[model samples]
Target: MALAYFNGNIVDMDDPVIPIEERGHQFGDGVYEVIRFYQGKPFMMREHLERLYTSAKAIRLEIGKQQNELETLMLELAAKSGLENADLYMQATRGVAPRNHLFPKCPASISITVKPSRELPQDVRKQGVQVVLLPDERWQNCYIKSLNLLPNILAKQEAFEQGCFEAVLVRDGFIMEGSSTNMFIVKDGKVQTTPLSNYILAGITRLAVKRIAEELQVPFVEKPFTPEELLQADEVFLTSTTSEVLAVTSADGRQIGSGCPGPVTRKLYEHFQLKVK
Candidate 1:
């Protein structure tokens, strides 16, 4: 089953909820989150809410509900959907107002939907995926999970056109991250990724990887690595709420480290599966 929520009402997924003047739809003025539920339980729901609120605050928009309240609503909605494995997508917009460049004086528009979780093909995950490097043509505040995603969408489409699964975004000759995931490279048995900055998003799954690495006694370093370094590394991987831990076997038509999922990536993913249980 699938469901949609608008303001305070739970409705059918196909129901018309938001109006034409919604800021999120009009100007992409909002922030959103996707929480994965496994066995009817949410994975890191609190962390997701914290990031959502952080993004809302960064954009000077109020979500108009406490974290716990939002969490409860999400849980109830997911439960109603009855999907054991689900993805709850929620967003908060500035509200429906007259089309203008200034903020409106209306209550924030909160919309949410819960549907089946998406997963890649088993063979694709087993063999790993390919990515193409693209310029980071995005705003400097990439840290905020804002609704403005034209640049990202374009990069992803370009990667798809190039027969790639993802696009690794680069700025100033260094890898920032994937269009939607955090990028990492394994070198000499250590994990290296770009450090947290305004140019990079602090991914929740990336945080999970760090903690799992510490628990597994794997050396995880947060340092920016060049595309050349990534191409020459022992292995490359990416992490995100939806993608989880995925390997990158090639980039820019160049094979990376035997062009297979490496042992470290496999081990980390194995542990990540257990953590989500």
Candidate 2:
């Protein structure tokens, strides 16, 4: 049976006793983070937890457990789940409260779950994936990894309907990022991605990729690029906890650089694989 860490207790996956009036359920007053674990050890767990704390603070939610305590609970839960490779999902909510919009007076409730790891399909990794461009209708505070994600959900659904793997959100004709991933482009043999602003989520994998590019002496640019520029890029890719480094072959029916993963993309992908290993 899959074991889960719920409300400070390790129990069967089905035994999580979330209260009916949980603020996360009623008002989406919560934040979450997913950390990838390889060979039973989480990668960049400190960065993930730091981001989680930042998100919680942004929403005025306080975690009941300290950072070290949460990390211990996560590791213990992963061991109990019996997964050598997995994703640890941690969330903190404002706890159970009456059906009201005001902030709850109680401390937040923390929960964690371990799930089997998922990797990008081999074909996608080799040939690159396709994406559709959609308008960015999310709230202004996109930096916080909040639980309210209706706009993202709808955009991803639209991409799925069009036989695409992800959606590239366009705001004011500029490409922000994928619905759940950070977008990058290669032009003139230089790597480029959007700046860390309220327009996009500051992705941990994205930061790692930037570091890798710098170490390899590759030119990296963190500037805003439009969807038109993204289409014209010699190579387009995305970074996320699960997607890792995946090339994009097409966007909005336009072929990107012979409609295949370019040489630079392949090089970076190989380099990223070594890091994960």
Candidate 3:
């Protein structure tokens, strides 16, 4: 049975004690972080937790415990759940409130769950997946990993309806990123991605990719590129916590780079695997 950390206590998954008035439920006032674990050890845990702290501060939600305590609890929870490889998700909400938008006087509530890790479909990783472009319709503070995700959810649903795996959000014809992942493109043997900004999430995997690119000596540029540029690029990819690196083969039913994962993508994919090992 999976164990969860709730309000400083480890509890069974079936517990129903979370108050209905919890601010997270009533107003979506919370922040979260997803950390990947390998062999019972969380990969890049420090980085994830750092971002979690930043997110919480952005929303003025204070965690009751220190960073070290949270890290210890996370490892303990993973061990107690007997998870060797998984995703550890932790969230903090502004606590229960009286159904009002006003700030509550209570302390924040912390919840953590560890679930079995899921790998991306092998075919999609190898053959690449399709994506559709949508206008960026999200709030300006997207850099914070908050719980208000309705816009992102709707965009993802739209992508699914269009028979695509993801949506690349465009603002003023410039491709910002996918609804839930960082976007990258390769042109003329050079790699490019949007600079970290309020328009997109500064993904941990995206930073890792930059390191990999530098080590591999691949030319990289952190400049904005347009959707049309992506459509004509020799290779396109997306990065996230779950999806280390994925190629984009088609956009709006149009073929991309011979309609297959390009060589540069394969090289990066291989390097990504080695880094995770």
lDDT of candidate 2 over 17-38, digit per residue (tens): 8888999888888999999988
lDDT digits (tens) for residues 1-277 of candidate 3 = 4667789788777888689999998888999999888777787888888989988888888887899999999998889889888888888999987888888899899999888888887987888999999999999999999999999999999999999999989987798989999999999999999998888888999888898899999998999999889989999999998988999999888889888999888898899878777
Worst 10 residues of 3 by lDDT: 1-10
TM-score of each: 0.99, 0.97, 0.96
What's the CA RMSD for each of the models? 0.7, 1.2, 1.2
What are the Cα lDDT values of the candidates?
0.94, 0.89, 0.89
Best TM-score among the predictions, by candidate number: 1
Off by over 4 Å in 3: none
Model 2, which residues run further than 4 Å from truth?
none
Count of clashes, each model: 0, 0, 0
Query: Please, what are the lDDT tens digits per residue for candidate 1 over residues 1-277?
Result: 9989998998777777779999999999999999999999999899999999999999999888999999999999999899999999999999999999998899999999999999878998899999999999999999999999999999999999999999999999999999999999999999999999999888999999999999999999999899999999989999999999999999999999979999999999999999989
The candidate 2 region of ten consecutive residues with least summed lDDT is: 1-10
Candidate 3 structure, TM-score to reference: 0.96
Better of 1 and 2 by TM-score: 1
